[model samples]
Target: MREDFLHYVWQQQYFDKQNLLTETGELLTVLHPGFHNTDAGPDFLNARLQLGEVEWNGAVEIHLRASDWHRHQHQTDARYDQVILHVVLTADQPVLRTDGTPIPTLALAGRIPLEMLHTYQQLQTAPPATLPCAPFLTKIPEITRLSMVDRALLERMERKSATVQLLHQQLDNDWEATAWHVLAAGFGFRKNTEPLARLAKALPLRILRRHRHNLLQTEALLFGQAGFLSAANEKAEDIADEYVQMLRAEYEFLRHKYDLENTGLKEHEWNFLRMRPANFPTARLAQLAALLHARPLLFDALLSAQNVAVLEQFFSNESSVYWRTHYRPGRAGKVPALGRSSMHLLITNVVVPLRVAYARSVGQTEQVEAALQLLTELPAEKNHVLALYEGLPFTHRTAADSQGLLMLATAYCQPLRCVECAIGSRILRHNSALK
Candidate 1:
């Protein structure tokens, strides 16, 4: 009984259209139902209709009851004066203009098929589930599902591109600096993105570039800025380590040289509660330091990377010698380098978005296409959400497919927006027709 259902029914011509008439028994012919208005004013605008022997063109308004016009006080609003038709589910009262002229009314309560009503009701009243359309997903055509997923993937990319655009603006359109911040955030993964981004912001690329020639200086700057170089916080064993003492000394000199001020991101800001040893913040920062030292022109090289293999190679550099067998400064143990899975995540989240933003800013259509092509070349992501759609009609073979499924789960299914989703719309239409 929601007004959105009525809008859907009218927009799709789901109700019986034969021998249409108004409540006063005048023949009504809809030349055009008008575009549905999502903004303020009428429910529809620029409608062309035939009222008996006369042709009319204006806005159209719909309500669950004709009396709702008065309840909503549209009679006093100047915006509703041009409405040529007031279509309601029930005509409980007459709607008039300011000049005392009666507006044509159409009641669709009896015209809508009982089957359509039943189908819509079932979708709305169904018990809570992962996806309202999950039961009927297989019933939809494969082509229809594929088309929807394609659109969803683009939608997700567009949203991510917007974030990059905002960062670009904040950095005064500096692509390199924006990419640095973005890459730093990506290295943090999901658990510590904010702290890593803060670290990047506190220590600009210019500062890091100055010390790029010496990998130890670059590591000291990054680790020092992250508040991880404090000797007081380290264990006695770590304090006795020669490498830790060297970094502490190097950071002390750099801190004084740059006149840097800590941005209050202490060691506690990083989350290490249940994360794998390889994904520890200390290890990630070491990898980031190595990347900075190896690729002085990180953004430039990424932009010129011809394919996924080249991009993977760009991030394949190993960390410093001290990090080869340690996840943290105080913890010394054999730890693996950045794995392929982590690299895939960085490419998907950081590299692609950065490329898309830069390409869009510089008006390079081919680069944008190349960035999206990289995602299609990469393997699909495995996550809890993807597990929900494991045996669905579509195959998630690449990052593009997984991204599409993520968008579908979050934007469509999670919100129960069945009417707006293509798969849900098709299911509803089929069920309604069957009824």
Candidate 2:
């Protein structure tokens, strides 16, 4: 059996406690199980145990076999010196302190109920599956499932917030600049997120703000940094269109004026394979340029947004005039404007994460709550992961719900961490008593 299963049993006090004895035949009573230590010192800390008539307080260590203490070289390490009890699945050998004093040992070989072992075996030995607990998922109480979903959503937000915090640190705590970088990455979507992030880093918010009032110049800076304006090199003779010529000429002037460098970001870094035409890098960059031109203080505006509707309205801007009929520099077609679904994606992934990060950095508790509330207002994201939970007892009505399902699928279900999941815990708790 895995040590984690033993940990679960010991932490929950699931074994028979009617009569306990040490290997030396002394009566043993556990007054306290102690705090389970996740770090290196011991398995549990500050345990209070009553041995015979005397009470002892110290750390407790667990092992599969009593001989493992020596196998792990705990005899040579002072960290195990304070261990008051050696709890093992099998006491195959005696253990002693660094001073050669014999330590009390307790074997849980038969103390754990056989039914519980069967339940654990089912969870651990299940065949390869996406949702290991799927067979018993519907049996869990609705309230328990909902609570786990809520917890999963919060975990996702906390993880995203940590990423934002890292970005904020990288940007030297410039919230607006960090927001711009994150928003650009979001605009890139999955196919081109890294390239878009590189584009934002190469063209700083300060440079973009300098030309924000002039949309053409702002577009020129973005396109130039993204290596789009360099298309004039190979297709010099074909740059007959005035708009392309203007952007090329303007980018050259701005590139020289601001002493800007592309920082090795090439046009080829963008991926267009199998992506929708509207999601092409060219179209996305143009949309981003339009947003940048329109909103110089986009992060500030998002922070002041009292609700999701206001945030939606804030993002409701079409691409620049030149992009109305063009998906790329030379290609011209009726490309769709940024749709509602894409807008929701940006709000959920970019704006909310940014808001949460900024709120946490500035210690504004209410803003963090408001930012999370925005997820509840937006519709749930549609993806294969969320699709796995369709027709299940739970409902996916908002981004929060979708995020929670995504977390469950990736973190818990995919890893077969049934013992750690609330639903899985309940299923095992109920079924452990059945044969």
Candidate 3:
């Protein structure tokens, strides 16, 4: 009933060609149905047909009604001049092209088999997939799977690079190393990300450079300012012993100066559930703060990191002495170890972005190549996109191929418009050939 169904039937050869006749019962022969152009003009292009032994070679156009030629304004356009045939579902009125010559018309309503219509209707009414190509992925080749996986890992790095570029804009292009650390710290999300970022942002490089000798005091100041003290909240001591008061005064001054409001940050209500003490944001920040206190030039080393292995090494041995013994000040939870997600975050936010930004800062932008190479060090993610590829014969083992799978999943497989996919066309054609 729909015009698209007519197009499908025409393109799929759903009608019998033998013993074909015109409405007036003249013998008809189709030489070429013509190319089905999706754009404007005739529905089919450059057709060759024979009507009553006079071979006609021109374009073919289709419509629901023979009068659509006028309805669509083809009569006013010269592009319809070559239209030799106007095939319609019903021939209600004689149609003509711009030249005023009558185009040979055929009503296809009576020519196509009822069985073909039923088959097409049933096929179109089938269920859709959650992941576009979920149903048909099993038919894909294994080699295609690997290619898609590798692409996904690279896709993550590319996304990380984009995120870093935004941070540069935020920091006014001031501190690439500090910006990378802040953004990388942000990925800890609502769970522990806020306090960590606050600790890093609060302690400026100028302060660290001024009191590089008092590393523990600097660490205690950063940690204390974040309200991480476990020595009870009832003390009213000097500015030095009153770590909370000193840090609070500093943070309040900074907040007003920077026009900032606290975000996802709380002294209490931290996520201790399913988290080890060492991995706790409070503990990690305290540890990182101490390490920064001890080695004021650590950011410089990170800026000079050459590869993923080097970056991994920096993160691997980056913990402080306090983190080794304590998880929290008041709480006596067991110390927890850092996980792989943290490592992934370090590579994505710190290592990759810092490299790209550092390269652009000094006019050596070739670091993009090195950044992308380091991204290949990680494995591809396992998400819905990968699940779709799993349905195919493809066995995804790399990040790049997983990204390709995501591209394929979003654009093709997940939509359930299988007939529109290249693989669907192949499957349909193969089935028809077998039949």
Best-fitting candidate, scored by TM-score: 2
- Candidate 3's TM-score reads 0.53
Name the candidate, 1 or 2, with the larger lDDT value: 1
Q: Output the TM-score of candidate 1.
A: 0.88
- For candidate 3, what is the lDDT? 0.60
For each candidate, what is the lDDT? Answer: 0.86, 0.84, 0.60
Of 2 and 3, which scores higher on TM-score?
2
Q: Per-residue lDDT for 20-117 in model 1, tens only?
A: 99988899999999999999999999999999999999999999999999999999988999999999999999999877889989999888878777
TM-score-better candidate, 1 vs 2: 2
The model with the greater lDDT, 2 or 3, is 2
Candidate 1 residue pairs in clash (backbone atoms < 3 Å): none
Q: Which candidate number has the best lDDT?
A: 1
Instruction: Tell me how candidate 1 scores on lDDT.
Output: 0.86
lDDT minimum window of 10 residues, candidate 2: 231-240
Model 3 ranges with Cα > 4 A deviation: 1-131, 141-154, 175-180, 183-190, 194-213, 229-265, 268-270, 294-300, 333-341, 356-366, 379-435
**Regions of candidate 2 where Cα sits further than 4 Å from its true position:** 65-76, 92-103, 127-129, 231-233, 236-238, 262-264, 432-435
